[model samples]
Target chain A: MQAQLIALDWGTSSLRAYKLGPAGAVLEQRSLACGIMHLPIEPRDIAGIYCTNGFELAFDTACGDWLDAQPGLPVIACGMVGSAQGWSEAAYRNTPVDVASLGQALHCVRSLRGVDVHIVPGVIEQVGLPNVMRGEETQVVGVLQGLGTQVLIGLPGSHSKWVEVIEGRITHFDTFMTGELFAVLSKHSILGRTQQPCDQFQAEAFDRGVQVALSKDGQRGVLSTLFSARTLGLTAELSPDQQPDYLSGLLIGHELAGLPDHARHKPIILVGAAPLCARYQRALALCGFAHVSLAQEATERGLWQLAVAAGLTQPVTEA
Target chain B: MQAQLIALDWGTSSLRAYKLGPAGAVLEQRSLACGIMHLPIEPRDIAGIYCTNGFELAFDTACGDWLDAQPGLPVIACGMVGSAQGWSEAAYRNTPVDVASLGQALHCVRSLRGVDVHIVPGVIEQVGLPNVMRGEETQVVGVLQGLGTQVLIGLPGSHSKWVEVIEGRITHFDTFMTGELFAVLSKHSILGRTQQPCDQFQAEAFDRGVQVALSKDGQRGVLSTLFSARTLGLTAELSPDQQPDYLSGLLIGHELAGLPDHARHKPIILVGAAPLCARYQRALALCGFAHVSLAQEATERGLWQLAVAAGLTQPVTEA
Candidate 1:
């Protein structure tokens, strides 16, 4: 019997699923906003359709029937579904993750209907570091396979991750919460009161903030420095457009200040959305990091590649 | 003829008005929550009862009222009333303040009722630095008078001020947004979702957070260290009770980390509400500044001294 391959990259707000042939070629692609948060309790019947015909068909209407039609297909899932609050915790495999040695760490979960469901395992790193990426790791590994070795991939979001790949092996990485900070500061701080929606980043303010971060006084003493942002803006000492940029610079500056000095010289590849990723690249350049590039659809692309490697998908050919 | 003295310490949330005898004795004290935010767009005649009495009252009401009631008594106002959003911007008076020189800063102005009012100038210091205190200089001067000589006075609030006084002179000071950071983090961050009402800070967690802040890594990169609070809490590594302490540690840690080396040797005096001041003192002790003291009514007392120097009222017996 020929087996169909289904790949899923599900996260907090959305989900992307793909169907592939044996050779890992994409046969069809589908996506939905039905993240883990939207799923109904005891959604076994609905979830079954998600694994087979994709979200185009109503999961609630024909999930069971769709599952029956694709009885022999193998399903692979990644992303937040592995979280404690998601489908179930996908037990993590500790780093350094050897792509070839990587195993299909699937949790054979039994749904409310007693149907067996397998969920992929997440990768855990830096025992003391409180960050764990589920779906993104698969994509990172896939990127390594697609673009041969020695790349630094930055996955930016509420919790931004920078993954290091050396010779096709997932070596080490770090996580920074820049996105979340922006959200909090823009909405909660005194800065929030005066902040307006403008894309302009005051280069001068960013430089000054970076200089402050680099000061012998250091970024660790930054809380007191935030008041300077207001002073700089209101008093015309710091340009208004620069407040956001200054905030970004301070955050990025601290990130650099805390980093192991060795990480500074490495070739960097930013894997996230534009504007923000561009901003990180700009800051890194200011900090003297010379080599940096960006990757598009890193998460989805990584998911598809991982699904293929897991013997669950076909290789895609140009349409 | 008898002269009445009035002093007002107007902060963001509440207005504290003191009726003082000529000798700087507290005759009566009253407080109201009608802060600047509660004031009407146009000033109102709200002092009908007190003015009806024969005794002159030195209350820090609206600027207009202070002017209207000016000729009869000396009115000294301190605190946020000097910020740009307040009645007027008081240029910061730098440290090593000569209270004798400060006493000469009284300005005469015509009131709305054609009365002559004496407006005390807000002192400015360290012209280039963002460091400035409007009313706090008077309070710090009072603290110096009451405590004698060199001391570190930490005033905690929406904007926490750390002032260093040397030999009765205000040397230098810095401000930290501890209270504001706590409020923002508790009400707006991802951590806020898990926050419970934290009326009394959990000492253990606060201590632990202080330790975290004391980390070589923590101090060097605190701007980034904030994320650890969320990660630690969300991962359940840190208890919910520890959130506030962690936050307090972040703020206090940054303060301790950024403090000028000179402040380390000075005896610390905390000036604020009982609970918060005590907490700050405790945090300071943990940070190795063990010699700490608390000042009650530092704001009110500071206001009185400034009021007396302005000759708002004649010396009366100590109440």
Candidate 2:
């Protein structure tokens, strides 16, 4: 079973390349820390002259670099790697976007190595204050394909996205810096100074954080609620190892609390790494959302759908 | 006139010394970046043997180091310099506390050099979850003295405090990590990567941030609203240079928005460095608070009042 297409999820810190079979199943995948930002050459000059360890390289050389043991397949790339600062600037597609429309808006860059390359355009909400998502849109599209209904979807990661999918189109969405905030606060803030590293998640401490966030009745919200992580430690109610899980719960709880009223009552399709999805699942349950389902291979599925829709790959028959 | 007493505001990052006249007026003042953390001696051995640049030192050496020309005067110190890891562990005074009670709670350490030294006890709210304030209590006391009535006081800094005073007593208060959040985010987060050095505050950008925070209608609060700083930049709604002020406005706006509903309707007495207070004043006005007053010499005045209340200094008549 030879690889039929390459699906790339290129972000700031890492690059994931999935080799998809004819049936759109992930045949094999490779990941490297050499993200867009790690490239030796500037994004503008990446398409032209560039060399890595005495080898001449083009901007699209990532596909070649990762396919050392296999032949190069047609590539479909998403995430920040397609931004203005990426290999080729793929203009953002405005909202009310669907998988088909996103496929139509794909930015095809001429590959120097004769392999076809297409970059998915990110989605932008242009009404009022603008909000944009690059890599998450792909996963959202993937979830849309699987769910195929009006569903509230949450893609949680460094930057979590909550989208309202209505009739297979993204009607509205919001991006929360919850993961980033948790990272920054835990690593840099006073509340994080005493945090001891732990391998296991402390559900008790996490639940305490969720309870506090949910029970908040005063005008004091996240800003003040955050201080409790420190106070709880100082008062001996929380231990050093418990701080991380508690902080995670607090942040996730706050994010869940902020969800639009309509999204809160309904079941949410959560898409992301298992650990983060599980944390969100717990927080969602605590926030009164009864049903929270997880979707696997969201990025791969979405990229595959976009590839088929864009005529870059053939539709795979079901088993 | 001879210096009657020394008032010290010793914090995590810096130490300030004010030489007060008989009436508690600041006759002369000095500051150094050598805060408690910078001291070479351990908190336990601070009262014993220590040396700075080959000279013998003690727990009260900070006052001695700064008072090279004048005779050593009795000192009143406040802030984190009195924490468990500070010069001496001053106990926290649980609140619903009055300035008189806090003054009475001052921990006077017997100086080896025979100089009288009193460290003002910090206030702790231990009813539900423990919340503590060190240096701000002094300033709140000062504001209470000046206002002599019920008032909502905001002490803005690394940790901003919103306090309620009735009959010259601190009835309740809340702490916001706004400034610290701004510092960590701007210096460490992705939104801060494009920030450039600028001396002047960008009012237009700041107002935009405040407006966005105020206009937030969905479940997305600060976590979501913060992304606008990045999105607005990507979409060209905000520039990199304007990010600092805009972030300030956003955090300040969120802090103001989180204030107890009753506090928002009343005028707030803001006490802090001029620049921070001015920014808060602007944010408060934008958030619909009609009256905002600035309290000058808050820390010094508060320290003086504590000294008099503790009977550590002679009460002098105001000119």
Best by DockQ: 2
Which 10 consecutive residues of model 1 chain A have the lowest summed lDDT?
A53-62
Per-residue alpha-carbon lDDT of candidate 2 for residues A1-319, written as tens digits (9 for 90 to 100): 7777889898877788888888689888877766777754433333354334211143345457545456456789899878877877899888888756788788887664455578999999988778888988898878776464778999998889998888878878888899999999988999889888699989999988887777753236688788888878887889999999998888888877778778866658999989889998888888889768999888998899888988887887555
Question: Tens digits of per-residue lDDT for model 1 on B195-272?
Answer: 555677677777766777777546445545666676676567777766777777766766676677777787888887
- Candidate 2 residues B123-219, lDDT tens each? 8898766789999999887777646477899998888888888887788888888989999999889889977757888999998888877885422
Q: Note the B-chain TM-score for every model.
A: 0.82, 0.90
Which candidate's lDDT is highest? 2
User: If scored against the real structure, what TM-score would every candidate get?
Assistant: 0.82, 0.93
